[model samples]
Target: MARPNLTRPNATRPDAAGPNAAGPNVHRVQPGASVQAAVDAAHPGDVVELAAGNYPGSVTIATDGVTLRGQGNRSVLVPDPADHSACAAAGNGLCVTGVADDRGMPVRPVSGAVVESLAVAGFAKNGIAAAVTDKLTVHQVASHDNGLQGISVEMSTRTVLTENEARDNGQAGIFVANWFDRKGGALETRGTQVAANRLTGNRIGLQLRRVRDLTATGNLASGNCGGIFVVGDDGVPRAGSLSIANNVVRANNRYCEPNPRLDSVQGTGILLTGTEDVVVSENLITDHSGTSPMSGGIVLYPSVVGAPNARAVVTDNILADNLPVDLADLDQRNGSSFMTNSCRTSQPAGHC
Candidate 1:
């Protein structure tokens, strides 16, 4: 889809020298100014061009419609270089602290926002968080080395997250949670797209929970606890759909003793529990090795955290070298089919 070239009320677009053509209302964020201050000064359709510098603070954005494009992805929203020692001391000091886990004030709510071309690191928590918002687009951003997820979208609809890099997070790289308390308690997630991103060195590359009608395509996931984990909460998973294609999942270490226990180090390349009617197809899954017998290329079981035994579909995936097993722990109540999967040296023809 083509984006408009309009400027936000107070925000400015980049100039001739920057990545995108200079829009009329672009603003330049200097070294000393606070990130919050720059956000405050920005209006809808504005672009905040950040120069290379160390900014020590968090920013909360309330603008409903705007574009925040950084000068360059890597140099723009990086951690404060001055705080390197403190960051190392603090452990995983990248961007804002507590961006996920129902904490922190959001720079941009999950609704009606657009953020692109920014490098966000050292967040004590998530690099970017979206909750209960709609029609948000996050593109060309780099989120890494945070305490929690690189980016989290919770209870939002019609959101597009594309061409982003989520890596080295202490927890899951990207988590899409669509659980919200509406009138009389209901859950809904419509049309969420996660595409063309690189996720590596996290607990889980992408976690989808309590939502459906989603698409995850053209992504690369490696060196994490799990490549992709889809789960439901409390009860049987609803009748929703998830499509994953053209992605690479590999080398997920189940026992990442560095953080320990906070994540499921003994996890799977793709785990489906209490999640039904999902699809895993045309993806490359390889080199999944862990100490536990339950760890496999794809794992389907009841929940260790919540309820269990849901239906799912696992088909047409290249499963190779998944150590200990290829597929394991199918729930007795689970309703699914595993067909056309290429297993490597596993028993029962892909059954563990």
Candidate 2:
């Protein structure tokens, strides 16, 4: 679902900003007025331009090089899933709060931000919620049914959520978080770039909480329940380099989650619990089976008994019929490193 360009060109804003001399570059958005009043009357290298249809509310892009484009999927914004009071104070529907704004006083962040080709749906929360962000950019948007995430980046840096279209979101359909730094020790989202997205039916179709230098490539996480979840909520150590390559991760545990800690991540397909130097390569990760016998296709949930030192390297992926085993490893992770994975089955026995 590519080619819906909105004048692209936001490769994580390498110095972005254009049209100088105090004003005008492209600030359309004029029919009846709104879209945060044209982003509070544009400024730094402006370019508001939203003129297709339903733009109900929530919009916040505290100007930097702002470029909230539209008119691709006929520009829709929906919000009002209970009124976020019009977003950006704490609420979000399209809030790219980068470079600053963290409630009480923290300032200076909104760097070259850009949200393109709009279509963000019903959001009571995230449908694009960039946090202490950096050079942000979310292109070809189509974030659907969101009461929560459909693109939520926290503590962001070098952010670049590409070719977007995260579906049915109630939480995670492309989420890259990190933060922890009050007393929780360090951890701040390092250079990130979850590319070529299309994560389906949400609940964890591309997460990466407690992130670190990441680069989840060519995504296509299917049916979501656990298509690509990499956690480490707060063991500190700021996670590690995660480079999940060439993705296609399918049939992710299709909906269980009545909340037994999210029903142990339903029907998995790439669940790396206590994140570490991860790198599940050359993906095609297949259809995860249901009814939770720890449904799978790449489960490496280590990190409690002894903690910290949880590595991963399931290489050359193409994993087949994902059920109770397509490559399991629940804590046998003593520096984990499964070889040439073309998975059928593999546990604490032999690298496979």
Candidate 3:
């Protein structure tokens, strides 16, 4: 086991140099200094303390076990619109990727990474993505106004995304997706915890896709197209389990035809597709605007072949005043089951 010392050797001084000390280095990286220069100079467990300014550059964290903090989320690591094209191929504004699988999938393991206290915004892609690395924790990060998702944890396990705020992204706020290159399977995103997030005004708030034994709790999602999208795949969603509890999802729109030339999504509050062993409880879902002729507050549909029985236990929820269509539309073969709850307009009386 590694030593449990919180202080890294080179972290003590910004200019102290040696083998035992890369020198307590406080590099004030301006337009000329590369972001990779700061990262290369940092030793393991060191702190890359960014100044209070807009860094119009890209940063890739290659070292393990380091802390990159800033004066505040608002002033540090501001995305430059000019660099938007730089991230078009990578899929994230701040990309930290690892190895990929034979089926063109990123393989993530749980250990040795932490991204905290950075406010990343205004790129042409997802805000921050950590792929194929684990034991990772992203906290106090604000990601907004990106081309795609605010934050994406693709093929990652044992990750904790907490206290993050995602808003006005082109796609979902937080996405946990797996590559679908191989026919047999994509690896599971197990033991992942997404808690205490404030997601608003995005296409989809939180999408837990193809991950088993995942938990999304204590989050607030509002004014998005959909609040939470839990998906299961033909090969993976059958055995996966998603736990969505203690969230406040409200004012979302299902089948939203924002303009006359756009397509529509199916469900508004929670769209469960091709997954099993899901439990959505203790949530407050209200005021969803549905437009499609076949839309619902909560829709559970399966899209796999020859899979086991998919099950979703939805209880103790306050789903009220959702309209333009049905409240719940379930169309899978013996679809996701729901027990004693309230989809009524009123809470105690269960009026719809």
Best candidate according to TM-score: 3
**How high is the lDDT of residue 322 in model 2?**
77
lDDT of 2 by residue, 1-352 (tens): 1221335422222222455444435666643457776676666666777778887778888777668888877988875554445463344678877554444223566776788888888776688787775778888899889877888877667778888898998888888765422223224555677888898988788877666777889989888877887767345664657788888988886765565343456788887766677888898988788765456888776443334336678788888887867888867845768778776677765655
Ranking by TM-score: 3, 1, 2
In order of appearance, the predictions have TM-scores of: 0.79, 0.37, 0.81
* All models, RMSD in angstroms: 5.9, 16.2, 4.7
lDDT of candidate 3 over 132-218, digit per residue (tens): 766677888888998888988877777888999999998889987674223435346667889999998788899776677778999
Worst 10 residues of 2 by lDDT: 8-17
What alpha-carbon RMSD in Å does predicted model 1 have with respect to the real structure? 5.9
lDDT, model 2: 0.72
Candidate 3 root-mean-square deviation in Å: 4.7
Per-residue lDDT over 122-200 for candidate 1, one digit per residue giving the tens place of the 0 to 100 score: 7776677656566878888888888887887766677898988899997778888753222111135677889988888
How far does residue 298 in candidate 2 sit from its true spot (Å)? 5.3
Each model's lDDT comes to 0.65, 0.72, 0.66
**Best-first order by lDDT:** 2, 3, 1
Using lDDT as the measure, name the better of candidate 1 and candidate 2: 2
